[model samples]
Target: MTSSPPGLDLDALRKHLDDALPGLVAGPLDAAVIAGGRSNLTYTVTDGATTWVVRRPPLGHVLATAHDMGREHRVMAALRGTAVPVPAMVHLCSDPDVLGAPFYVMEHVDGAVLRDPESLRALGPERVRNLAFRLMDTLAALHAVDPAGVGLSDFGRPDGFNARQVSRWRRQLDGSRSRELPGIDALHERLAATAPELSAASIVHGDFRLDNTVIDTGRGDRVAAVLDWEMSTLGDPLADLGLYVVYLGTPMPAARGSHDPVTTVPGHPATGELISFYAEKSGRDVGGLGWYTAMSAFKLAVILEGVHYRYTQGKTVGAGFDTIGARVQPLVDRGLAALPREKG
Candidate 1:
């Protein structure tokens, strides 16, 4: 588990906000960096009474195109009528004069991203299963949402998404200093050969899974909000489905290995169960998802390799520093295996 950043003073935030907004009650705000997450610096802020969450770029060198808080805010606003639950977006400050970089404020959702064993015990097996199912349902709901209805017809193009994805990621990986990974190339070729048929354009939560979703574990463990829109884009929704299966099914154990054996995965749901649950909820066929899974595996490998590269270059923050970055090879291998074999 990652710890919040230390030494953040509320007085500084209060001063900054009061100077920026003028009349709105700002703070006696306490800012704590929520750890375990990469890509953004998430802080829990309070205005002496009401609480809000703010996200900004991490303290490091970032690509000019990445970490667009404006894109995040806009997506949240456009997803209003969608079945995906999103916290009410409060304010967006692009002017660096406010917080040193672009940032946004939104209604702080009360829930857990980290799994609590005790809390899981209270929720019991049925509710725990419900929690897992709800996440799948929400993703399906997001797919069902019409981008036109939400003023997002231009959000992204789903046309030829599967066909285009192969080249796009390969290009990104190729530009980096990392050695040519066969698994990545192999998976890319396989996906290109067996790309699935495209479907309707839907809101693709680039990252969606248990941790990205805030499940209100009260009487009913409902997903309060699907957070993290930094990578959200319009494209094939199956790509999203494929990612959930990879993280929940393939990556977790492969990530842990035999390093720790006593770990109990609560509700302890597996990938097949969740994917099936999603298919039922979304009314989509699951028979032809090999490409999606393979795509997910290659995508994760590229992402982790990028993390490895950034860490090696000393461009990332402390918690992101890990030997896990070195494991990109196995991810690629597994991803390649996930794809369907070509017919002879």
Candidate 2:
């Protein structure tokens, strides 16, 4: 059989389990590849007794400076008691001798990720509206959690986090390997010059989006868990909301390179609506958002360009991604200037 992606070798995996479990018998492990995730290999593993999800680094050489499996595990561990719903982390293996790299096991979170507007339309406007509101509320809860209260003082840097972020993503764009995107570089500079002062320090989900969440249809389409934590950090919580809006507002038609398979809503709810929703739930001041939204666009350009870089280097997982890469830059440019200064 073709080599299973990075972390799912069933035959050899059984050999390692004997030692980790000690007399616990794990029968032939069945692995189903969960596609669409960019950084690591996610496998749905079913051992006769229990089901688990294994997350590990991708098979190739990644920037050693980034992709810390240990950090991800630690953050997940710290989020145990908070309002944010997450798949419980189970075990962590850092020894390369065993899994060839660091990996972690987390409770399997079941749900569907919707991306297509048509599918969303099929779900009907009321359901679409409900999902949108729930998404906002769930994020509000995540951003509202106090870092110190959750035992996450070591989680990130709170001081000068806003200015530092501009510098950080700029470096990411510089390191990316690919075609120069439409307005990526210019937008970066603009965002850097116009970076807004953060109101308070709180947990930030660096990359929050529909696909990064598990939507439990059974709970009236409620979000069950926020899945990816590799990018979670401590910063202005408003940035997380800004990122959510950017992900929802991106021009989907061009980004998909074809009809998007997952249902997605458009025009991203006005920043005011989400701001109001979050304020009602968190009782926090969110006076600044326009600039954060601009920053969101800048970061997205770098991120999408990174994807484009990978696609150009032939590392993308699906068809038509190369074209999608081409489309990302324009949105980056538009989003870079989408917002205007809010009335003071």
Candidate 1 local lDDT, residue 293: 80
TM-score of each: 0.85, 0.86
lDDT of 1 by residue, 105-171 (tens): 7888998763334444566777776677777778888999888888888877789887877777776
Q: What does the lDDT read for residue 262 in candidate 1?
A: 14
Candidate 2 lDDT over residue span 145-197, tens digit each: 77778788768887888888888888887788456566666676667777777
Which of the numbered candidates is closest to the native, going by highest TM-score? 2
**Residue 98's lDDT in candidate 1:** 51
Q: What is candidate 1's TM-score against the reference?
A: 0.85
**Strongest candidate by lDDT:** 1
Overall local distance difference test of candidate 2: 0.70
Instruction: Report, for every candidate in turn, its global Cα lDDT versus the true structure.
Output: 0.71, 0.70
